[model samples]
Target: MRKLISESFFFCSFFSLFAAFSPMTIHAAVKVPVQQMGNKTVATAIGATRCLTPAMKSLHAQTVKQMEKDMAQVDAVVYAKAIETYQKKLSMIWSAMSEPYCGYGSRGMTAVKSSFNKSVNRMRAEFLAVTKTAPVAKK
Candidate 1:
């Protein structure tokens, strides 16, 4: 009976130590709320745009010019592809930057995607607005 008690105590101690060092426990320490996740994505997006070099800005200008041309031709497919690619790239960058905070878990990813969709739609609209306002070069 004494030996059984000692073994049980040893098992309890081992399990307690394992639980203390578990990934779930560590993750909880750095947990970011879903609302804050959206804020972070917006901040990151703004920072990304602000950090763009003149060359990058020029490229964006060219893209806008091209988009204006596409619009004149009523190219729905081109708009779809451009927006999808832009969103995917932005999401990829945001995901890599946010992994530490949001985690590799499905729930965390869903939160990031949901909040990003809401926050990033404004940028999408701005892109469309810029293309509409900019003059299209003659083909």
Candidate 2:
């Protein structure tokens, strides 16, 4: 009985020490809820950016049509004002996704970070090409 008790105590201590020193269960101090929320927000924003591209093109076409129609009846100042408004809207839409913060404070999940960067770069380059080629009316 004495030997059994001694062996049980030794085993318990050894197991406890092993658990305490285990590499698989290291606890981090940071438990910020905002980090996860920020990830969700970033994902939604990126999704919105992707979803809005077609709508943006449609709106751009509609604006160009209106501008063409307005140019016929409006003086230079009025046409300039219309063009300025359109340009401002376009800038705002582009700027919305320019500072995407999907990673926020995170070192970021490797696969997600890679994919997000790829998508953002692809879209940015496409946008840059489009803007470069798309004619801007003089103010």
Candidate 3:
């Protein structure tokens, strides 16, 4: 009886300690409602466009010039590829952000938003990269 009790206590203590030191994920506090998510997407897209405005201008000028020229297929191809990547990233951002968690809604939303932001940032970066403008360079 004494040995069994001691063994049980040891096992319980070991489990407790293991749980205490185990890696746990902390969630975000922001809970974006579903309707709000759409608004957020639109707002973020607008913000992204505004943020990339100068770069967009440069790209527009370059693209116009390229369009006027007969041998700008490479530029078109590059633009298409970059745009495709940006679209894919945008989709990923939305898909990841749309996960719904009952108890961890806020945390999940935060994680999703963070992921979405990263994807948007990457897409913006790719746009700027293709445009080759320094105006949108990170601060």
Tens digits of per-residue lDDT for model 2 on 69-115? 54454454534544455455545544543354433234434533444
Score residue 33 of candidate 2 by CA lDDT.
35
In angstroms, how far off is 67's CA in candidate 1?
22
Give candidate 3's total backbone clashes: 1
| 2 against 3, candidate with superior TM-score | 3
The reply for model 1, stretches above 4 Å from the true place, is 31-139
lDDT of each: 0.53, 0.49, 0.48
Q: Write the per-residue lDDT of candidate 3 for residues 1-139, one digit (tens) a residue.
A: 9999999999999998887666551223334333356447432221122112354335435543533342243355546665566556555544443333312234643544444455556666666566563234357
Task: Please give the TM-score that candidate 3 achieves against the real structure.
Answer: 0.31
- Model 1: residue 131 alpha-carbon error in angstroms: 37
Best by lDDT: 1
Summed backbone clashes in each candidate are: 0, 0, 1
lDDT of 1 by residue, 53-79 (tens): 354345445545654554565345545
Q: Where does candidate 1 have its weakest 10-residue lDDT segment? A: 42-51
